[model samples]
Target: METKREKFYMMNSMLCLLKVVEGKRTTVEMRDEKEVTGVIKHVDGYMNISMEDVVFKSLTGKKKFDKFFVNGKTIRYVHIPDEINMKSAMEAKLKEMCTYTASMRVRQEIKDQAWAKLKQKERRAKAEIKKERK
Candidate 1:
């Protein structure tokens, strides 16, 4: 029987792996011990992964093996390391979001200022006409 702490660790590890796959380009080590270093292109029904550049679809509809097949289990599911360096990618995304938010705020501010100015001009024009009529 697995302990609760063990189950929690497994869940956390799974979530971390999913984040790694979805977040940025990563290298995964297969069960065969093959260190496949490439961006994860896609994951299939059987959890089989197609890595970019490193793994190729041959003309015969077979996967071509690279130099290192560590444990000879063919191609096992890819495993990303517990920790991935995603600082730059995260920073770039955050910066993009901040820039978009800032641009929207600036646009709204400009619109508000323009509308206020227009209203003030209209009020001044109306007052001038009234004074002339008096």
Candidate 2:
């Protein structure tokens, strides 16, 4: 069975990989078939990110944003920049993340996850009450 610790490690690996791309011009292919190129300004452990000087392109045309935020779930593939040495960068980032404090977005993601669990509990309680009544 996959333990929670293992899952957490996997998630951290992804976060570290992305951290190495910080301040670099990178391209991200989103799930909706749109593509964005920007200088990644900030990235959290949850992969929630803010980018600056963004250029978004899709089949229709293109758009620009002074800044943009992307939810990690919507990202399909991240194109690592050509000049980056992946193995070294990943090793360095992993070390950094081990001692890193949670960013604002990561803190929010934690809150949101907790809220979702509470909602699920509420739903189950309601179902149990209904079952007793019936």
Top-scoring candidate (lDDT): 2
Question: RMSD of each candidate?
Answer: 12.7, 12.0
Best-fitting candidate, measured by TM-score? 2
Model 1 C-alpha lDDT per residue in residues 20-129, reported as the tens digit of each score: 36433555555544456555654432234555545433334435443222222355555544565555444554455457658978999999999999999999999999
Total residue pair clashes for candidate 2: 0
Query: What lDDT would each prediction earn against the true structure?
Result: 0.52, 0.82
- TM-scores, all candidates, are 0.40, 0.64
Off by over 4 Å in 1: 1-85
Candidate 2, residues 19-88, lDDT tens digits: the string is 7788999999999999999999877656777899999999999999999999888999999998999889
lDDT of 1 at 126: 100
- For model 1, which pairs clash? none
Candidate 2: pairs in clash: none
The clash count of every prediction, one per candidate, is 0, 0
